[model samples]
Target: MPHSVHTRSDTVQPRPAAAASRGRWTYRLGRWLGIDVYVHATFLALLAFFGLRAGLSGGAGAGLEQVAWMVALFGSVVLHEYGHALAARSFGIGTQDITLYPIGGVARLNAMPRSPGAELIVAAAGPLVNMALAFVFALGHTLSADAGQGAFNAAGELAWPLQFAVMNLGLGIFNLVPAFPMDGGRILRALLATLGNRVRATVWAARVGRVLALGFVVAGLFGNPMLMLLGAFVWFGAGAEAGAAVREEQLLGASVQQAMSRRFLTLSPWTQLGELAQRELDMTLLEDGVFPVESGGAVVGIVTAEALRDGLHDLGPKGYVADVMTRDILCVRPSDELSGTLRALHGRTLAAAPVVMAGRLVGMLTPRGVAAFMGGPQLRHA
Candidate 1:
C-alpha cells in the first residue's frame, strides 16, 4: 500500500542522455544503497522556504534544527523508495533511478514484473521501510528520555523527540491509505490483478485514486495548504495514469502502418542544404524534413533540422544533405506490431523513424505523430 498512489510506471521510457542532463542536479546527490538518486532543483526552493519560516518563527537555532529534521525526513523517504527498488530488483526488474521531488519520491523502473506476488512485494516494501524508521526513532526516544536527557521543547508541554517519532509513525500509516498513487491502492490493484486483467485492475484503482484526490482537495479548503498541493498532485497523477493505460490499450493490436504518417517527403543525399530548405519553405505540405531514400532507391537515412544546422556551421547552407545526414538509421516494417514499434522508439535516440515496407519508404513514425494519434486521430479507424 505504501507504493500505491505513487504508481507511475507508464511515463517512463528510455530517452536521450541529453534529457537526463536537465536533471543533472538531481544526480549530484550521488547514489544510495547502490541506486542512483536525484533530487530536483525545486527542492532547494523548498529548503529556502523552510529556512525562511524557521527564521521568522523560531530563530536561527530552531530554523537550523527544523532544516536538519527535514533533511533526515527526506533521507528516510529515499530509503523508502529504495525498498521498492530493492524488491523490484530481487524480482529481476531493473530500476531506472529514484528521483526526489518536493512532493515525494519517484522510483523509475523498466517495467512491472508479470508476477502478482512480485508486484505485491515491491509495493509493500516501501511502507515497511517507513515503519522501520519510525520504530528506530521511537526506540531512540525511549533511550534518550531514560538517560535523563533534556526534552527538546519550545514550551513546557511539547516533547520534540516523541513528536518526531509520532509524526513518522503517522506518515507510515497514512501512506498505507488504499488509494491509487498510494500504497493501499497498489495493494488493491495487485490483489485484483490476480483475479482479472492487470489493465482492468489498474483502471479501477485509478478511478479510486481520482476520487480520493477530489476528497483531499475538498478537505484542504479548511486545512493545510500542503494538503491542497498534495491533493492537486494526486488528481493530476491519477488522470495521467488512466490516460496512459487507455493509450496503451488503444495501441495493443495495431501496427506501424496504422499509426504512421503517410505524407512523408523524401530527399536526395546529394541535395544541397540551401535547396532543401528553400523547397521546404516553399512547400504547402507539413514537411519537417526529408529521409534519404538511399542510392539503391531504398530508405537509408534521415536528415533533420539538427543535421542541417550542423552542416550550416561547418560548410554553410550550401553543404550537401549527405554531409549532415545520419546513415545509422533504424526502420520498421509497416506490418510490425505497434507495441514492438513503441519499444523500438524507446530504444532509439531518434525523434522519428522511417517506416519501410519491402525496402521502400511508406510512412514516418515520430513521437509527435504518436501524440497526434492519441490526441485527435481516431484509434477506431486504425
Candidate 2:
C-alpha cells in the first residue's frame, strides 16, 4: 500500500520557499515513468541494523543473505506503490514522487481521486499487485519442488524463494485489514461514500481504524514491536485523515477571493534591503511577513521578511530585493475554491501565494488570512 499519512508530498512545514521540493534527508534513486524515486536515509540505517544483527547471530554470509532479503522485500514494496501510481494515472491523477522509508514506500498522488469508484480502484490496486506477486512466487516454488528441487535444504529451513512467497502473501493480507491509512481502509471509505457524504464516510473509516489500532497495540503487548509501531502509525494516521476531512468540509464552497488579503505591501524588485528596513522602522506596514515584488504593474516574485533580514546581514544594505525573492512563485486564481487551494499549498514552503486573474495580481493568500476567513460567518455557514 502507498503509505500516504504524513508523506513528504503533504507534510507542510514553515521554511524557505526557495528550498528544493525533495526531502532534505533523502537520496534520489532516479526517476521511473516520470515519477522521482527517493530513499530516506533511515532506510539505509534499517538495512545496516538488520544486517549487523544477522551477522552477530549467524555469520557474514547469513548477514549478506538477510540484507538481500530486505532489499527484495522493499523492491516488492516499490512495485506495490507503483501499482497505486499506475491505477491513479488511469483516473487522471498524477503521482508526484515515490519515497522509500523504513516503514514502507509512499507514492504521493497529486490529488485524491474525485470519485469514490475511482478511489476504490486506486486503493485496491496496491494489494492486488502484492497478491499477484505472491501467486507468482508460490508458483515458482511449486515448480521447483515438482522438479525435485526441494524448498528446504539439509538444514530443513525454507529456501529464500519460499520465504519471499510467504512474505508477499502476508503483506497482501495484512494490507487488506480494513483500517485507515491502509489500502483496505480507503476501500472501506470509498464503499461508505457511495451511501452519501464523503466526510461522514471518512469519519466512520477513522473510527474503525482507531479500534483496529487498539487491537494491534494489545496484540503487540504480547511481544511484537512491529505491531506496536504499526498500531501507533494507524492511530495517528486515522486522526489526521478525519481532521483533514472536517477542514475540507468547512472550506467547501469558499473561494480564494473571500479569504485573500487585498490590501498589502508590494516591493519593487530593485529596492535595497537596507532601505526597506529603514522604511519598516519609519511607517506601519502590513503585518504579514510576505511582500509581493511588483514591476511594470506585474507581480514578479515574493520576498519574506526573514529573507529580507538575512539579506541585510549577509549582503550589507546594498543587496537588491530581487536577490532574496523567490521567483518560482505558486499562484492561485481568485475564483479557485479555497479547499482546493489549500490542498495545492499543503506541502509548499511558501508563506503566501499571489492571487492572480487574467495575468493581473489581485491579492495575496496567507495562512493568517485563511484563519481569519475560517472564523468568519461565511465559513461558519459553510
Candidate 3:
C-alpha cells in the first residue's frame, strides 16, 4: 500500500496551536523515544477525586496510596500504547504522540498499514504486551510467595505485584473483546479483509461494533457508569473510524492541482502591518484568512490575520511583513496528491499553504480550498 506521510527529520515538532493551547489544561509528564506522553486534565481530576474519596474513607496515607496505585496502573497503559507505537515503528510508521486519558491511552500513528498482515501485527501488539506483563507479574508472585495473600484489592494492604498481575491480565482479556477501534476489532477487520475488500471489511466490522456498543450501553445501565462511558466512546470511535476510512479512500484518487486556487492575495515583505490591517478590514471578513508574503516573484513566507492583529498591539503596526510572517513556510507542489497534502496539513497551525512549482508560488491551498475539493462550494473569490 502507498504511504501518505513523510518525515523531514528527527527534530521534535512543537504542538500545533490547538494542542499548545490545550497544554494550559493538561500536564505533559515527559517524552521518550521521540514520543511525548501527556496526561489529560481529566485524568488529573480522576486522581484528585479518587484520592480525596479514599482519604475521607480511610486517611491521608490511604489517599497517597490510592494515587500511587493509579500512577502504577496508568504506567501499564503507557507501556501498552508504546507497544503499539513500537510495532508500528517496525513497519516504518511514525507516531505523533501518546496521550493518556482517564479512559485509556492512545498512540497517534501517522497511518495504519492497509495490508492485513501488517494490521494484524499492529493490532495484536498492545494486548500481547499486556499479556507479557501479566506473565512477568505472575512469575514475581510465584517467586515472592505473595500470590495467595491480598491480590487485586484497591486498598494498599494487598501486594503491589499481585495487583499488577491481576490488572494486566484483566486488561489483556478485556481488550480482546470484539469491538471496533479495539485490538480485537482490528483483528476482525484484518481477517475479513483477507477474504475481499478493505472498505467492505470495515463496514462489516463497524456494523458489528455498533451492535456490540449497544450491548455495552445496556450492560452499563445495569452495571457501572464507567462501562456506560466506555460504551459511548466505543460507539463514537467506531463510527468515526468508518468515516475516516472512507475519506482516505476518496482522497487517494484526488490531485491538489485540481483544487488549488490559482489567484490569491499576496503581501510584499516591506508592507507595513497597518496597511495589511486596513486592506483586511476593507475586504470581506478576514478573521480566518492567511496571505502569502512574496518577494522577487517568489513566495517568502505566510502571514495570518490573527498574527497580524496580535503583532499590532506589540509593534505599534509599524512592523514590516518580514517581521510578522513565518519564515518556516510549508508548501505543497501543484501536482501533489490530495491525500498526501492533507496528511502534511493535519494538525498544523498555518492558516493556508502555498502551492509552489519550481520554487515559484503558483497558487494557494486554504482550508476553504480543501473544503471546496471535498464537495463544498468552490470559494475562489480573491
Best by TM-score: 1
152 Cα displacement, candidate 3 (Å):
12
Taking the tens digit of each residue's C-alpha lDDT, what string does model 1 give over 143-230? 7675655555546644766666666677678777766757667777788889968778878888888888778878889886677776
Superposed by TM-score, candidate 2 places the C-alpha of residue 10 at a distance from the truth, in angstroms, of 6.1
lDDT of 2 by residue, 244-283 (tens): 6666666789999998989877889999988988876423
Which regions of candidate 2 deviate over 4 angstroms? Answer: 5-22, 147-154, 262-288, 291-303, 307-363, 374-382
lDDT of 3 by residue, 1-382 (tens): 0001111211112234537533456677899998888889998999999999999999999999999989888888888888888888999988877778787887777678889999889888888888999899888776777456544455555567767887888887788776876777888889999997888888888888888889888998999767777777678767767665655555677888876777677889898888876765644435456788999998889887777788887787788878888888678898888766765665464556899998788888776666656554322210
54: Cα error in model 2, Å:
2.5
Rank order (by lDDT, best first): 2, 3, 1
Clashing pairs in 2: none
Tell me the deviation in Å of residue 176 in model 3: 2.0
lDDT (C-alpha) at residue 77 in model 1:
78
- 1 against 3, candidate with superior TM-score: 1
lDDT of each: 0.70, 0.79, 0.74
Cα displacement (Å) at residue 365, model 1: 2.9
